[model samples]
Target: MALDVQRNWDVCMAENLERVTKESDQPKDKKDARETTRAEKPKIWKSEPVYLPDEIIIQILEYVSRFHESQYTLASCCLLSRQWYSAAVPMLYASPYLYGKNFDPFQAVMIPSRNLHVRDSPLASLVKILDLRGLVHQASRRITARLLGRTKGNLEAFIAPQASFGTNSFAALAKCHQLRILDLSLVSESPPLFELLKTVSRLDNLTTFRLPRSSGFSTDVNPALITWPRRLENLALSGGIDAHFMHGIVALPSTLRSLTIEHCPSAKGFALMHMLRAAVRPLAHLETLKLANLPRLSGSACDNVLFILPGLTRLSISVDYITPALFDFDVSSHREAIECHYPTLPHAESLPTRHQWTDGKQCELRTLELTNSGNPGVEDKVSPIDIVIALDEGALPNLRQVRVDKTLLWQASATAADVDALADALKEAAVQRGEDESTSTGVWTF
Candidate 1:
């Protein structure tokens, strides 16, 4: 009986030993599985610190002066580093002018439906500027509505001609409260151009405005022409605009500093002179004035306008018909005109006389550019080169820098001897005036 009991105890001890070994192995297996998971974990790359500072990035962007060619590359720079992105995105989106082809992709995707609304979509926030050129087809109305719905409050500038902004486009644009600038230059077919302009009058932020050839709007409307933004400064007008329109424009915000009138044919020489007389009185803040490609501006009219706005620092006038005879200063017309119109103010003190034909006695005239008689006509008998020489020596006594367009120089029939004589005269004049004898004067010849 004692042997049988000892055998039973040995059997029980074996079973206990087996159970202990299984329990220990199970914990080891779990620990091994955990170790395998840790060893196989995936690695991720961390973002690197930006190498350049923000100011340096801005300076680099400023150095990239040619915007059109470099804009795409510069825009991509935004994705490269956060600093580069912040600096380039504003410039990239600042003056967004869209041509005709830019609307293709948008048009393809914007499947028109009576109930479609872009405002409900998540893609609405990406758009800031919309250029709807040659987009006035049947699909235009729907596309314009969608675009406006998406960007009504966000859009800052809209540059579309009259045709693109038919009734529907106009209605959509009317909702754009944040619009600051409008360029309506390419629309020649649409008659409701004035209506579009009238709609924009409600925009308190509308500042810079460009109008194409035709005063169809000005003729019909007599209201205050522009209720521009308080910050409105630059205005560019092309083709023929009426005198009344000019007056209304000048009456806009007094902050106007730059004004450009290009290819305005209806502005007769004398009529423009009178308009300048009336307009320059209030636009004393104007610093830069450019009148280019106007066919009717006579030399006398140009001179009269210049005398009226003597406070102008940068003046660009391209009147090919002007002659010295125009400067004959008829007592009845010019003397009283100059005295009455030219104001002697503190701003006039800094006016550079580099191109003004004045006796060098502490004169105030900064930069003067004049182009005359580049076209072949009976009127261009006097060589422009000789006139330039005479003006440099006599009229522009305080001359600092002069740029003569090559068109005038190429048309001049002066011989080599004449050219040499003119150069010598300029050298003598420079010496007498105690001015640096640098070739700051450029003669552009086409």
Candidate 2:
């Protein structure tokens, strides 16, 4: 070892001497000055490692991967090196928007039976959002279950496909305690409602849930039979929900903040009114209520809404359900006026009083949306004149935006003269009150 070391040192010194002798052969004093300059000059090319720390490099690549169209950038990053690939691979698979052409490839990757040693698969744990909304004829129910089984521990939001989601899928889904949102509204052939509810209620972290769209029921919902998850906040029910469920006190947990009921053919005005007065009114924190495409809800259906939920801020219901009574500023003082002028119930006075009406309270409604544009209930629906008069009389004083269909617009109404007169009165009232005008006294749609 010593002899080899001495030989290598001798070779290096000999090369150094030959180079110095060549430099000295060109003028002695100049060579000495040149050698001193070379020794003092800083080396521009660095020989030490020039790279970021693993943690910082990972963070930078993860940030770059967040852009919607940066898949190409992420793909390039994965090819960079083993460290880069490890950091970038997780982001690439975390939230897969699997649809159309890519569904097959993804299914192959997630299926445990097809791949060996999936028990400790890091790819399965990395997936957080698995949305298969575009699926139709591409997959089967068992495949969905397999996918769920692999991702159960970490899956937070899962939008099940419109088809091929069945009982097998729920077996895996019920175990996903970390789930937050499950939207199965588009399912056509769904599992039995009772079993479905029972399965999902076990999800401890579920917050937002959407029921199947085809869910109008023949009988009322049994609140006692159901165990609602306490963390749930947003719920959407289908048009098939039974009238008995709407009329009777249905099981709406107090945790709910937003509710949507649409395409309910069996829900009559009286049933809906009963629902708001009984089931919904008790929810203190309720803020957004949407009722749309409900054909059976006829004639001033939501007239008594303010009396039910005074704290409601955003409302979307059918046009026929709304009336001048809803906007009566002196509604607190004129209970008789509502009974006499209601368009739907001319004999409201004669009907049995199912609800113990509350003292008429001011609504916190800021946005009012009117749906069912094609219903064409010109005479029965709340008119623009009613809105103008209501605004002028200081009803819904805090209202800011009103949305309705283009058909509801009075831009070319044959009876525009009446609405115009009412609009002018509302403008004058706004000016008198020193408030900003425009609570949808202009062009609007739902």
Candidate 3:
């Protein structure tokens, strides 16, 4: 019986071994089938690699180029493919405005060098404007010198303020033949600053220019070199500007439409009024004039100058003082001076004579803005009654819209009841004159 059992065991062991062998073979067969399928499939042409269309890649490059200092990353993209390199190279050198603190030394060297490569690239002709500010001091002067040497003709607008370079740097900038708009503000260094201005004046194409504070030009300096551009439309001068600068500005081509004078502390007493009258008399097409932070001139000085600008549609004057003479037909010495100086103005016509100037004339003044911070003992000491009288007589006659800050009216001590009374008076006057009272708009609040 033991022998029979042994034989049965042997037979079962053989059957189990055969079953394991079949299971192993089954796995091998499946593996071979997969291998055959992979081998039989046509090989994809991946060795050469399919790439995005050139136009799409170019678009991505253009998008990245819009960033100020994207040149490094964009240039690195060139290594991806010849097509990518070609697409990114031009945009890398496009109009770049360099400002703020992040601008480092490496970027300065790289930007101009990259620009050199870009100038040689298909996109070299595309760059137009270059704005270099505070961060330029970090760059090697050599890099700036090189850039100024290379792309001088293509640069249309150049803005560099408070840059640490010397007059030599500006001399390099002057070489740019196509320079049109130049803003050199906050540059305190006199040698480089003057040299830069001198160079700018020589550029026949220079149309728009901004000087740093009022100290840009010497008081005794002749402004004949600072001629107005036929294309020049906007001029902004700070209070530090000397009377000679004003003379230069007034002598500019009549094409000027906007003039902004701020913080002219040097223009104290009657000189401010004299400067305004002289500066504005020739600007026939003058549309907008802004004067702010002027401590020397009073509200009366503003009115005296404004009436001379008949074509003026928008006027903004922020002064510390307000007076009834500002709006009233007061024949004081100041009024007499205005009449004697500017005979064409309406204020001069009714001098000591209360003739209605607005009787036949269409109201040309569209907007009037008066703003003052009613700081105790700091701003104007005029009463609200004086301000109201000024508005009633001076403002209501020609202004279509008036914007008076609460601080200014409060300084004048005008109450809500006073405002209502003034509005009613304006309406009554407009009705009597057959004019539209609805056209009058006033904002008492800030």
- The prediction achieving the highest TM-score against the true structure is 2
User: Which residue runs of candidate 3 sit more than 4 Å off their true CA positions?
Assistant: 1-93, 97-102, 105-127, 134-147, 191-197, 214-216, 224-226, 244-250, 295-300, 321-334, 340-363, 367-446
Per-model TM against the reference:
0.60, 0.72, 0.60
- For candidate 2, the per-residue lDDT at 292 reads 78
Error of 1 at 161 (Å): 4.8
Model 3 TM-score (2 dp): 0.60
Per-residue CA lDDT of model 3 for 128-169, tens digit only, reads 666666554565455555555555768787665454535556
lDDT of 3 at 390: 51
What local lDDT score does residue 9 receive in model 2, on the 0 to 100 scale?
A: 100
Model 1 spans > 4 angstroms off: 1-67, 70-102, 107-124, 128-149, 161-163, 171-178, 190-197, 217-220, 223-228, 243-252, 296-300, 325-365, 369-401, 410-446
Answer with 1 or 2, whichever has the higher TM-score. Answer: 2
Q: Candidate 3 vs. truth: CA RMSD?
A: 10.8
Q: Which scores higher on lDDT, 1 or 2? A: 2
lDDT of 2 at 87: 83
Candidates in descending lDDT order: 2, 3, 1
Worst 10 residues of 2 by lDDT: 351-360
